[model samples]
Target: MFPLGDTHGGRIPPLNQILQTVQQNTDSLKTYISAHHEIAYRSIQQHNAQLAMFAEAAKLQSRGLEQFLVSQEKANLHIREIVGLDLKALAREKQAELGKEEMEKREPMLRNYVHALADFVEVVGGRETQSQNGELNVAASVATIKKAEVKPRVWRRG
Candidate 1:
């Protein structure tokens, strides 16, 4: 027969190779855990950083919305003042001088002021979901006020 004893292999030195293989497996497991832990820590840090950025952005957006509301209030006040002046002019033109006709003519404007003032108060009163339309609704309010008739008062014509 052929040489069968030391031909292909001679048991292949099993002891030392087995020990080295076990050590390599252990090392690989340790390295994997370390790498995984590092990745997890980095991911947590990144998420926390993004959360902070989003919070800051939300704060800035809220501030901008507040500024816009303030500007709208100012504009409404200006319009109301102008409307008041117009009422005064109308009184002057009629030569009523605070008489019945003048009062009647000014009544609608007064009502408009009341409504606008109420709306402004409601919006600025810090209630939830305050009016977002702002000064845009003032014209509609004015029109509504104007439609109400002013009752004529009896005058003594001094």
Candidate 2:
């Protein structure tokens, strides 16, 4: 009953059906690959846009900080000049007060007034209030009032 050398009986697959199945699978794979490529391209574009925005914001912040530092330096210089002028005015006032009649009788009162004013300035101006040991350095402040004078012991308290 053997015809030639073929071992298959009669269940051989049709060539047309096999080819069609292969074509359908290939088409499905192509569609999926195209969609994936489009999505990847769009994601890259969005990321690039976000990166550009971040870079611009950082540049603006750097500029703002530079401006602030410049203004702060100018303000500090102005404050020092103002304080110098105030000290000179206070010295003039003290001289006038001491020149009055019977100066010796009111010397104590005038000294107290000057000390009070100095302490007020130190507090209001937010200057350092403590000495080397955390105690109030009233004399140190008074010494600054008379910059030319060299009598340190006379002004020191305690």
Candidate 3:
């Protein structure tokens, strides 16, 4: 009257064999997790490196802009000096004028002054004469000339 289920042979698989199988599976899983973790870490490192590089580039751009502004200031000063000298010369010539012959001689000087003033305006103001739609604006050129007269002198030797 032995138990029917355990009648023939009550032998189970060896404990050592079961444990070996479990260890092999665990090692495989460990290898997979380690590999995944390594990949994720490398990806994060690369992303951080890219962000650092971008930040450095932005800093360089800002420095470049600062340098450009300083250069523009210097150029404005030079332009002012040249324009002042030209205007003074024109005034002196006009003051010394006697008749129509003097006026005739001064005409070319006046034209030169006008051209120089226009150039100065274009350099100082951020206005562009060329339209995006390709239409020329004659009024813009006149406005630029008037604008030059009102611009503060960058060079005033005190």
Candidate 4:
């Protein structure tokens, strides 16, 4: 290779050679710095994109939760409407009316039930305490005698 400039007594390079080396180093440093800057910029943009996606997901979740809460509140209001605002006051207001209505509705059914229960008891009591013309009534099993003696055998473990 042909030398661009000779070093004086091999102690110091020429001024032009020194300047060229410095310029090359400076150019490499600039290139390296620019490459790193581009990488960092791209990384920041990707992070922002990901953050935006996450934010949108969070917003959707928040909206869904809000809708759920609204529905729950509506359901509570509907139940309150069905049940009334003050149950104690309502019960107090309806006590006499409900009692009279319930008694009127159940009186005939209760009477029939009592009559049926009395008839059932009478039939059951008559069957349980049966008498045949003032004579004693006995079960056939109790009246029959066992001519053959029954002996229960005990099993022994061998």
Per-model clash counts, in order, read: 0, 0, 0, 0
Candidate order by lDDT, highest to lowest? 1, 2, 3, 4
| Alpha-carbon RMSD of each model | 9.4, 10.1, 10.4, 26.5
Q: For model 4, how does the per-residue alpha-carbon lDDT over 59-121 read when each residue is reduced to its tens digit?
A: 999999999777665554443332233323332344344465553554453344333433433
lDDT of 3 at 31: 100
Segments of candidate 1 deviating more than 4 angstroms: 1-19, 86-91, 94-158
> After superposing candidate 4, which stretches have Cα over 4 Å from the reference?
1-10, 85-158
User: How well does each candidate superpose onto the true structure, as a TM-score?
Assistant: 0.45, 0.51, 0.52, 0.49
Deviation in Å, model 1, residue 8 alpha carbon: 12
- Clashing pairs for model 2 are none
lDDT of each: 0.56, 0.54, 0.53, 0.47
lDDT, model 2, position 142 = 51
Q: Write the residue-wise lDDT of candidate 1 on 17-44 in tens digits.
A: 6688788989999999999999999999
lDDT of 3 by residue, 28-137 (tens): 99999999999999999999999999999999999998997776666555444433344344433444543455545544534554556545544544433232221122
Instruction: Give the per-residue lDDT digits (tens) of candidate 2, residues 1-158.
Output: 22323534555556676678788889999999999999999999999999999999999999998986666555544443433445545544655655544444444544655556455555535543232222223334555545533221112232
Superposition TM-score, candidate 1 onto the true structure: 0.45
The TM-score that candidate 2 achieves is 0.51
